[model samples]
Target chain A: MSAATEAPLLELDGLVTEFRTGGAWHAALRGVSFALARNETLALVGESGCGKSVTALSIMGLLPPANSRIAAGRIRFAGRDLVGLSEEAMRKLRGNEISMIFQEPMTSLNPVLTVGFQVAESLRYHRGMEGQAARRAALELLDQVKIPAAAQRFDDYPHQFSGGMRQRVMIAMALACRPKLLLADEPTTALDVTIQAQVLALLAELKSAYGMAMIFITHNLGVVASIADRVAVMYAGAIVETAAVDELFARPTHPYTEALLRTIPRVDEDSAGLAAIPGQVPPLSAMPPGCRFAPRCALREAECEATDPALAPLPAAADHRVRCRVRAPATAAPRHA
Target chain B: MPEPMLEVAGLRKFFEVKRGFPRATTVTVRALDGISFTVGAGQSFGLVGESGCGKSTAGRAVLRLIEPDEGRVAFKGEDVLAAGKERLRALRRKMQIVFQDPYASLNPRRMIGKALTEPMRVHGVGAPGERVARAELLLAEVGLPKNAMTRYPHEFSGGQRQRIGIARALTLEPELIVADEPVSALDVSIQSQILLLLQGLQERRRLSFIFISHDLGVVRYFCQSMAVMYLGRIVETGPIPAIFKEPLHPYTKMLRDASPVPDPTRKVAMLRIEGEVPSAVNPPAGCHFHTRCPHAMEICRKAYPEWTPLGDGRGVACHLHKV
Candidate 1:
């Protein structure tokens, strides 16, 4: 339980990210907060438009051109607040101390640049190692990622590499500086199952070897189960539930989380006819006044519609937190389950 | 067993590629080297594989959407590949296809009613009034409200649009519907809704399906039996339970190992299959998967392994499974 007492490597408290859409500023991520310990894997799992990516973009300070910005919250990284940092200061931190990887490797990697040059360019820019030093380091990084015949394929273009191999190059570039924190946004979404496994295995191995903390954002729960030490289930722009990976799956505290875990069919087990959560995520503009998930919640009470429930720790578990009216509140008996 | 509902044997399709503009040498992509399978009537058969594995191509080749260079596609003992344009059109009414992308498949310019009714009108199924009635019934069957008939595709969400696509596929009352990655684009919550809906429809209509998808979980749930395709060949084919429990082919076993169970106690192990799938344009000699296979033998690179049938209606194409 040393992790319980130790200071988190990255702590986001009450992160409220806003996006300017249709002449209005809407909060896409409403008060998302989580802590990542050193060498920990925190999986941010949710469906599209659930603010999983927005949280990453906000953390990375790579929000889109429009007025998308973090309106509130403190992003403390190693005792330093990143929210108020200048672009120049943030730029220095990025790709050196904090690295990020996107889902689409084909689009993320420069098509015109050679794989070796792309990997080496980071080493040169971030580490100031030029010429042969950068090239040799790049080759070593590629080999570390287990790309077959890394020496021979140095000059190969992005188009020449397969989807899986191109992703390996992306990983090599991200790991070139050995950042303390890695923000991977659905890194293996576009890959085949086998290729995704290979990438994930490589990522896990690298994460442990480098002793880096990660905020892995993905929509797939199965992938989260495999790699994540902790899981944060988000819905409609807020963290609905957070728990240790095994405990959360064993006893899901939030109704949304419960529905979500039961919804998808698993390859390993026979499916009990899938249970749907019914309606879609509410639009940002038409966000309801009270509990955001009330309309879709099965155990919706009159009180649930009038007052918003703050995320609180579950009664039995100190670490597990949930933002649901039923099945979580210490005062409220478990009604839904 | 009465010639099966559909039988595809030794289906082959090739694509030509040219590199340079002036003096480009034409390269041949043997997309479907030779794949064969059978789908019983009222049964769902899965075509599982990763991207560029030719599962989609095989699905289309069976319906002659992309005419194969060789092999036979028989539907209910009728030669589908040999059918003329008129016969093909008639055959198409019996074997419709549900596309992977629901949003792109439907015409935005037309109303949902028009899109659903057009299929019935093309086949001259009934009078104009009856076709409209049938279209509404399809909407109801696919879990969409009747008011959905007048709305355009953009009005509905991805899941609703997919339901509309399923409705459109069901319009002609087709016997066999080819659902190509139907739920891949949907959210996990909605994916099961569609899968359940599809299963209900399958039971009620007795629709035989050629279910093609990359997600093995969805395939395992929806399909009774499946054929695992790799570089355009069925590496393993068997009942879903047996295949899931004990896969014979190295590629098939790797695929199973690669799929992560939604349980944190189960961590995905190190990959046994290495390297990316080779380009289909010039597949390797002998076993196409030898480049990545962990158990590749000396003979694997020289000669293609013969298909070994293990008497339980299950089989694999691998040197290790030689019988």
Candidate 2:
């Protein structure tokens, strides 16, 4: 309940998550570390199969049962290590201390139950409110999300709501507990452009109003550029770069990040064709050595194929950092110091 | 100027849904209500709209993929709707389709090599070795590695599989390709790559395209002309700049406003349209978007607005532009 200045709202220190597939273990998150400051919006930007969602799930302790395991690293929440917490302990944190909104609202929300009931169900379970109290609270949350006629639509099921409205309900449900941190995984992907904009703005407003630290995971640079305070570029199960939004966009250090920015269709510049990364993000099981992006990187060199790059700050900036074999060495020591 | 490759006039496809059982209540969905447009010999025409607005259905109806209940479709001056099965089959050589979901559209069991050559074989355009050579050329043309020929749909990433889909669609060497949300399923970075590939193929093959999508940004980049659909009908049709800069239709304005401005500093007031899309089976009586239009007039609620041209090849179906 204390201010997050003592420790981050959420911090993953050298987190490693793996899965057993094809009779062998596959590393989904390899020595990943990051922190979500209070009221900050950190975007995890990556293409499909880059483990952004997996990282989010790992933070929420919602990994699938198959062969999923957080092999190493500490997840500190309010200065307490949550990595080895029991299932009951973790469940207590979910929705009360932290909450998450999934990508597709249609699938995430209960179809048969009334949306009010579904939203209220979280309140009843977490805050121990029942029946009328829960319903009133749910209506209040919906009104807070600016859903018109919230009280009148309390009995209407999820199918009765539009895509955008359903997403609002989802956001309302996620924020019902007033959690300190919120994780949104591609919440606008399924909605139309207009609806997507509304949801993004609503999330921004809610984050500010609640003073919540938000981890927004999305593949759209446009979305990231709009809402993210800081951007984390991920490729093939690794954080390639992390920087303040303006710095990341203005001067991308890693070639992968640079190529990604180039590949985006800009309304300003006139280009013959997009600068493609040339190859797909390699399969997690068959990750390339040295640099995970070397095969697809345009600025690859001989040394890139021999060793992995450690994420470290650039010479000029204190916070901006990039992971690249050519640009960043394994150790932080200066080359000529 | 070269002759138009495709022309559509007053195209209408209505679906009558029978619901409830006492005597059977009926409702008519005006999916594509009297929409008209044309694509030049090698120009890309984009049709964009939210889901259930009937953009996909319109594309399918244009190609005679689905039998339209009304209106005219002409491909190279031949009436597509009136054409017989044999004529339509022959016309298939001039047109092909690439679907939005690459994995769903492509046969997962078949290898990429086979999928690329199957279309060419169906058209009986080349010999086995010739088909293989053409397939390899297409794979390379889409910027796929040579080794990708034998890979199955599951083996390739979403981007690579989309490239393979493009290669397959290009194998027939059709003059026009109806791409239905082709890049909507991929990442933003990969989407640009696919868009660039599509643009390149358009230039080299001199291919015309009917690109259908919901993203206005991508459409603006790829489409030479634009058409905005609402609840199953075209509300606005014009050049890209005209539509983006000065959208005449209320729905088009909302779409523009809704698009997330890449810059956080510039706050664009989203013209939020109230109410959900009316049931397709039982759409509103007049002006399909009237129920949700912010500037809906009384006439819009009672009578269907007439589609009028605003000159210079721009037209909007709205009462505000009745003049």
Candidate 3:
């Protein structure tokens, strides 16, 4: 889809985010880097406390200002640097050019306000559409997201709608401004499996329909396979593996990614036992000195425990990359600018 | 089959809810409607369904945690519902439950050792000193450190807390454990650890489990037989691998197809059914799933489908399956 030659819609070069905890700053995201092509769906896959959510928050400029800070790195979005952007400028850009939908739709939505008003409010604030025009647009967006009887349910408050329907309302509001980018963090995790499929399908359709690049953050690899064009597997606050969706599934290079794939019980096949990752994720405050994953990695060598690995492209496929000292060592030079 | 560990028949639990602002009319919420299943000795029977489909209610009702409206729950041929208070209390020793949220189920202020041993203390299983030793042994069996006994529930991670919950359930040496979504709250990596631990315990202890969960993959992995519930009714019930391979009921088929497989080769099927699950209070007239069933007919909408036995312990309730 002409994404190859086009400039990346968003790029993060060595992004580091830290939070002040117990009088000390601990990095949650350690030098994370990725480039999102226009209209591409990049799935950020990781377990909790692995900094996937933090990456999304960093991009949205929504991190808690009191304790969290973007210690280092540049977040360039649509030809503009967002790391140091003022709140006023970011606010205008947020709903207009970038929007996000959270996991719990009920919490994200205002219970007091009607769903229609919430959707219309974004249009009014961002696009200057008012009154009847805004209402009509909001209803149309809801219909687009396949909210059944959208017009009739327009005046209903968030509490009136079911879990799946509330998620649809959230999507409609996020899409109201017709943003260029959408950051969705576990948008369907709370819904039932059937409803999750519905929401995922809706997201895929809308992503293509709007031609918007999306950063879908989720711990579910199944969801990644369904929606992602590319995937970045994060582990202990670092991108351990990155590849096209098919390639990542076919040949997961990073030990963490491989272990994770094996750990999940598959619906399609039967296995004797799930291969559990040996230990829990290291807490941010007590992160390993060298390779973050080395402590739990099966193939960890002595060298891995001494120095962290660089994220380098694989020799077989240039697009596929992994941050592992043993698996995909930095023998080959960096190819990307 | 060794008289089966547990047999539930016509289990029903209903709650009356008052709705509306000014005039609240009492409506019966049929959380569990005449659902039944049997868990054989050392067998794991999965009650699979979405939220509000009564899987959780059935689990609780079987244990008499929620009194059933109309049902016979026989634990090793002993009538659980008809048992006396003293008899029921004794029966509870052999049938423990593991809740979905371990954190919520556990007393945060209580020490992990105390939580583990308190049940034995209540049941008068052993001396106070012996209970403490049993608690330590249980912790070791669940792969937690003996020292973990001294820590509070809040100190441990979600996975560790779940292990503690498992240990507490085993204090009475229960034959049947009603594990309700035990791993659903944990991360995928941690989920596998818990699953493996549960499997190990089931194998070692010969524990019969009423594993209630919405995850088809997990249910398929752990359960030998399963009952797929929809709107408080069993739409399909059969042996796993087989039922999952060729699901007879439309609702079961939809659920299987909707479950996202890890492999990207098989694209998630376009949802065959539309609209969220109808509220239990106002479930559709005849067959509860008729409204959303892809192959629903006039007959399905007119009368609830009878459970047609397909032999070999397999059955389905659907108009299309009628002879």
Candidate 4:
């Protein structure tokens, strides 16, 4: 096997990304870590301002230098540590070996450039393929993403395409280089529900056909269950739990995950009433010590109030695991086939 | 149901768009074209559609925030359009509105206490201390802390700000409140909390609410009756259970399928709404949803379908459902 195949496609080890704001260092990601295998789809699921997108940006080296910094961590992709990589080196690595598709296409893509040029510019720069060759590749990628009239509409600008079509162009641009890893950050939030399903299905098909490792970041558990192979629940910049999709949905170990899951409206449910999470997410600057979710968690214990929980394997925990001080001794087993 | 709390018939509002430097030819954005619905006393009615479907316009029309070119809004057996300025202002005290953007709706320069009390002051209800006590009670009803009265809008989070907006609306103690996309801007977990609060307040106060939103799931959970709007027209009007379980109109079905349910294993059959919603400035003839409707017949393209009742109180304007 090749070295890239032997090693994980992307491996993060104890990644700590901090921001220096108001003259005090605030750690957004506290020793958060995970590994992405080739052709695997891992979902980073959490509520708003939960550091999921920040984690994605850290991987892409796109964080603003003024406020944020990677205090300490190892971001290894295909056996290369990206922590200390030069700007030029990182720029070269981006959009070629690795690519990212942000949340909103209308904002992400340049309004001044043609859709074709936006996609082909990366091909021309990364692969040094110029003129007709790059243009041809761009059209082919658009067609692959199921954009209609790709040859004719490649000249259209970002505003000309509808929300769903613009997102397709974004996907086409991200897949131009056939990158080994694709980081999608809330790719379907701006689109309407029907359009969201189409984009998600397109991503699933494209991931399988290209065998690309995808880090799908979102707050919607429904999206995760439909597409994710494994799920990681994050809170206050920490991976509170990780498990197979079915296992996590059937039985969430962390109190935060359980509360988050219960708060969502279910398809099978017929109740006219909503089950609400009582409190809002705590601000990062004034987060309480110990369990970050203690204020909102229903089953919070005294132990949860005194000590910070670390990711650990419960006595009967499956490959599934939880990061909490007072987890039940018995692992939450799969309840569904 | 005792003449209903509010009844709208043939409501239409067309905005004349000015174009070019000279502003020669005018284009009209048919924001609301002959839409109708009724909100029963102490009942919560939902108006749902995608962004530009005129759901907000319908809510505003009911409150007379915007004057309609044609149609009538009968509020408690009296016509709102025919009411004089003094009468309208007097009627306004009975019908209030809670806007969608809490941050923008409330004056940023004003304190929460002043914002809440100002409405009651204008209506000339009670003295200062009584108003203050009432405002504090309303704030507590919406779940904001008592100390929140002294703070500014910027100091509060989205959910808290929304509660302040609710408190301000409750200051009037109106029988009907027009809530326009009240919780869409907040996060999902926080959205549920606001919904529960609204539901609780609606019950405890026996307030009638016309809830306008693009989110079908939230509407299904919160509203007993719902009207599905499309391009400034009501395509489906029925009870929530009937509409969700057996949606008669194509657009209604598409909307139902579009909502993201929490169940991961539920493979929702793919039913997409074709093309972007047609601009309200130049809507096609016949059915408003005909351009994108999958079940559109030949007659639907050329002629508008009349409101057809489907045995029960449920009514739909689709040709396929007509009998």
Question: If both were scored by lDDT, which would come out higher, candidate 3 or candidate 4?
Answer: 3
Model 3 spans with C-alpha error above 4 angstroms: A335-337
For residue B100, give model 1's deviation from the true position in Å.
1.0
Residue B290 displacement (Å), model 2 = 4.3
User: TM-score of each candidate?
Assistant: 0.96, 0.92, 0.99, 0.93
* Chain A TM-score by candidate, in order: 0.96, 0.95, 0.98, 0.94
lDDT of 3: 0.91
Model-by-model lDDT, in order? Answer: 0.89, 0.84, 0.91, 0.85
The CA lDDT at A55 in model 3 is 98
What are the candidates' interface root-mean-square deviations? 1.2, 2.8, 1.1, 2.3
The interface RMSD value for candidate 1 stands at 1.2
lDDT of each residue in B141-228, candidate 3, tens digit only: 9999999988998899999999999999999999999999999999998999999999999999999999999999899999899999
Considering chain A alone, report the TM-score of candidate 3 relative to the true chain A: 0.98
Encode model 2's per-residue lDDT on A1-337: one tens digit a residue: 2433456778888888999999999999998888888989999999998989999999899998688999999889888898879899999989888899988889999898999988887799889999889888999999999888898998898887888899899999999999988999999988887678778878888899999999999887777888898999998888989988888878888998888877765443234556766767788789988989998877889988888878877878857888875766545652211
DockQ of 4: 0.50
What does candidate 4's lDDT look like per residue over B147-231, in tens digits?
A: 8889899999998899998888888889999999998888878888898898889888899999998878778788889999888
In candidate 2, list every pair of residues with a backbone clash: B31-B232
Give candidate 4 regions above 4 Å deviation.
A1-6, A314-317, A328-337, B1-3, B18-26, B270-274
In order, the TM-score of chain B in each prediction is 0.97, 0.94, 0.98, 0.96
Compare the candidates by lDDT and give the number of the best one: 3
- Flag the better candidate by TM-score, 2 or 3: 3
In model 2, the runs with Cα more than 4 Å from the true position are: A1-6, A267-273, A325-337, B18-26, B127-133, B143-151, B267-279, B282-286, B290-303
Q: For model 3, which pairs clash?
A: none
